[model samples]
Target: MRVASEMGGVGGTTVMLAQETGLARLVEALEGTAREIDVTFARAGSQLGEGLGLFEGLKERLTTLSTDLSGPEIARAGTTLSGLAGELRAINDGLLQETGVLQQLAAHSKDASQVLERLLEHMRLITILARSARIEAVSVQAAGRDFGDFTSEIVALTTQAQRTIQNCARDHDHLSALLGSALEAQRDFEGRYGQALSALAAKLEQTLVEVTGRQQRSVALTSDAATHSGKIAMAAGGAIIALQSGDSIRQQLEHAIKALRLLAAVTAGTGEGAALDAEARTAAGIVLRRLEAAQLEESARSLAQDADSIEAALALLAGDTAGLLDLVRSLYQGDGGRSGSFLADLEADLAEASDLLAKCDRARAGVDRVTSAMSTVLDTCQQTVAALAGTVSSIVLIGMNAGLRAARIGTGGRSLVVIAQELKFAADQVAADAAQLTPTFAQMQETSVGLKSGGRLDAAHFAALDQAMSESLAALRQTGDRLAATLDQLTREGGGFASVVAQARLSFSNAGAMSDLIASGAAELERSVAEAAMPDDPAAAAAAAQLIERQVWPNYTMVGERTIHQAIVGALLPAQAGAAAPVVVAAPAQDEADDFLF
Candidate 1:
């Protein structure tokens, strides 16, 4: 009976030790897996957050570049260029009209010069007729002695008429010289002005072409950037969803770890195997609840969504980058070179036009001086004509006096009366010629003023337009370059974000798998503990005790003089029921030196 009781006690203790060892190992596995899950959760959350952050940053940058900077700048540039092109076209049209006007003016000037030539010839003919009349008067004088003073008066009037003719000829020559100089200036201005306008027009057309091309590219690139920005926003949202799943998984792992620790504590006690099994089942229930709550499958679904969203975003960004790259390629291919050439040509045209304008200013100054000199010469001619008029009037009066004297002397005064009448006609003719010169002088002054004012105004307009166009083109180019650089940076960052999201997804998957493994291990350990055999018979307990005493007790006692073996033996060796005396077992000689009171 005693032996059977000892065997039963040893068997129960052995079963309890086995359960404790299994529970400990199971707890170790659960803790290790939980730790791994925690690490994975942290890493996945960090990665997901980083990816989302990068995507958001990229979105913001794209928004600023596409919406705030590049888009508006491109549109403004397009509008400005369109306006400039219209202005250039209008200016070119005006230039064409001005060229036609200049041609007409040149033609009219030639005609006016020809008319002046005829007027000069007529004046010479009139002077010759006056001289012939004077010679006839002198020849007839010899026929009558009383005609001597009349003949002398005729000679004086003829000499004065010759001087008047010479002065008119000099005035005509001066007017002709001024007309020749104006005609040459007009021809030179027309040629140079036309060439400058034509060159400017061609350059403006080229610049417009390049601007239009870049505007199209900007539209496409900005559209692509906007699309990519939307995609990035979606991707970031998806990544956040995936990270939420990782959070759920982490929570489940923590519960599992807690349940496993509870199970280990219960199994390590001296409870019955059935109680241990019950506690393990309870732990398993907790694990199941944790798993159900973990929603690993949901996490996987979220990860899939994240991946799809990221991929879509990547595709959008890739397309955006491709468009930007095409624009960059276009810029690098030949657009920049063409633009530079256009700028260079425009500058050259502007410089030439500016030089022409300077020349025109100089010409205007020269024209002013010429007009002033001509006005002075005209004033001098008028003075000379006035003096000649006074002299002719004096001659006429003298002829009149002679005629009175001759009339007083009877029919002898007839010759004197004819000379006085001739003198009066000659004076009237000279006064009429001087009156004609006033209108010609006024026309010359008006022409010089028109040319100076008109040329200067056109030159100023050309300079202003050219400067505005150059500044606008330069600003557009700068905007394009900055946009290209921004696109390149966004592309690089988008790629990095994609990579981070992918890695995070993989880590989440691994963590989920580890959690499942830990749950499986806990369940298996519980099952093993529940199925483990327990010795119920006292005889079997006695045999197990004997084996433990021979093997386990000796080794266990070596750890200390008084050990847990003594406590267990003392507890297990209580007296049997209806026994008269307590059962005392003899100590072995080898254990005699060891004080064991059981």
Candidate 2:
């Protein structure tokens, strides 16, 4: 009877120890899971912070960009650009008119040049007549003694006339050169300069329209991004709150696990079987209640919801960022080859226009040169005509004197009189030719004056137009570059924010999975505790205890606690009651509150 009683005591102690060990293992598992959850929650919080930081930074930049776009400066710039475009169009129209005028002037100059060429031919004829007169005078020198001086005076006048004719020919050549240059310039203006100006004006108009549209889009996108950022921040805040809640739940679980371990230790140390049983039953009930009320499943669900919210917010932000990227890209891309980018096209067009304007200026200068040369020709012609008039009067007076002298000298004087009359006729022809040239000279002078004035006006317009185009294009390029850079930064930040959100999402998923696993383990522990509390025969109880110690406890044993299995097995199958009580090997010392299962 004593032996049976001792055996019962040994069995009871073994069962109690087994229960305590199992509870220790369950507590350690719970503690380890709680620690893992806490760490995951912390990491998730950090990721959320990183995501929120990126979002806030991006929001600030976008807001600033939007503000700049809507500011008075941008409005003024747009207005200035519009005004410049209008001015360019007006200038282009004026240029077209000026080009037409230049064409007309070139044609008129050509006609005038033809007239001058005719006049030059007539002057050459006069030179030839003068040379013939000089030769005749030299040949007829011996025909009359008194006619020699008169003939010499006639020869001097003819030589002077020939020199004047030569001067007129030189002036005509110079004028013709000037006119040719002016004509070439006008042709270039018509073909290249005019077309470039028109194209630039059209491009500016298109650019202004596109820029205005992009500005509006940027404003709208920025507003939307800001709004979305607020949503994202709210979502991150929620996730942070959820993570904080999870951390609190983890702490609660740790405390509950510590309490369970303490209960197990108390149950194991107690010597009375009934008290140990009652304590074990109480511990099981407490653990079951705690497990039911722990609300870990709720935390997991909340975390999942928070993760979903973050992902959704991130998606919206990504969409907005993509839209902004598209807007930036559209600002610079062009339609075809050679027109590589809008800025590049504008720069090239402006450069070509500037060169064209310079050419126009040079052409105008050529017109001025032509005017100077024509004026010189007119003056020379006037002087020559005046000299010829004087020369003709001298010849006529000399011819009349020779005739009088001839009448005195009789037959010898008769030949001299005929020569004098012929000289008079030649002088009359020269005078008439000079008279005709006067009107031609006046007409040429007037035409040249008109051309000079018109050219000056055209040059002024070109200068103003060129300046306006350069300024407008430069400002537009600068603004566009700045906007593109801002958009690029926003895009990069958006990507970084998305990455952070992704990491947070992954962390949340892992934490949720871990939480679910812990919850399941808690449920299983509760079921095991309930099963252990049921009434069973000694053999069955021992079997149950052995099964739990060997199977369940080994699975949850703390790291570096390999001897726990031997301790548990030895406790379960102690030596026969009289066989030194199997040395009752004690369990390894463990600070259950601080220990972990994994």
Best by TM-score: 2
Write one digit per residue (lDDT tens) for candidate 1, span 1-598: 1111112467756865775576567557656755665576577668767766776667565555544242565556556555654554554454454344444434444454454444445444444544544455454555553455555655666566556656655765665566556556655765666466556556655665765665465456556656655665665565455445544444444444454454444444332213333323333222222332233233234434543554454354345444543443453234443533222333444455445445644444434444456556656655655565566566556656655655564464455455555555555554455455545545544554544455433545655755765665576566646655665676577667767756765665554456456546645643543433333344433433343233223322121212433443433422211121122223455555544321
Model 2 clashing-pair count: 1
On the 0 to 100 scale, the lDDT of residue 456 in model 1 is 38
For model 2, the stretches where C-alpha displacement exceeds 4 angstroms are 1-27, 46-57, 67-161, 185-194, 214-222, 251-303, 306-365, 378-450, 454-503, 522-598
**TM-score computed on alpha carbons, candidate 1:** 0.45
TM-scores for the candidates: 0.45, 0.62
Error of 1 at 43 (Å): 8.1
lDDT of 1: 0.49
Question: What CA RMSD would candidate 2 show?
Answer: 11.7
Q: What ranges in model 1 sit over 4 Å off?
A: 1-230, 243-310, 316-449, 452-598
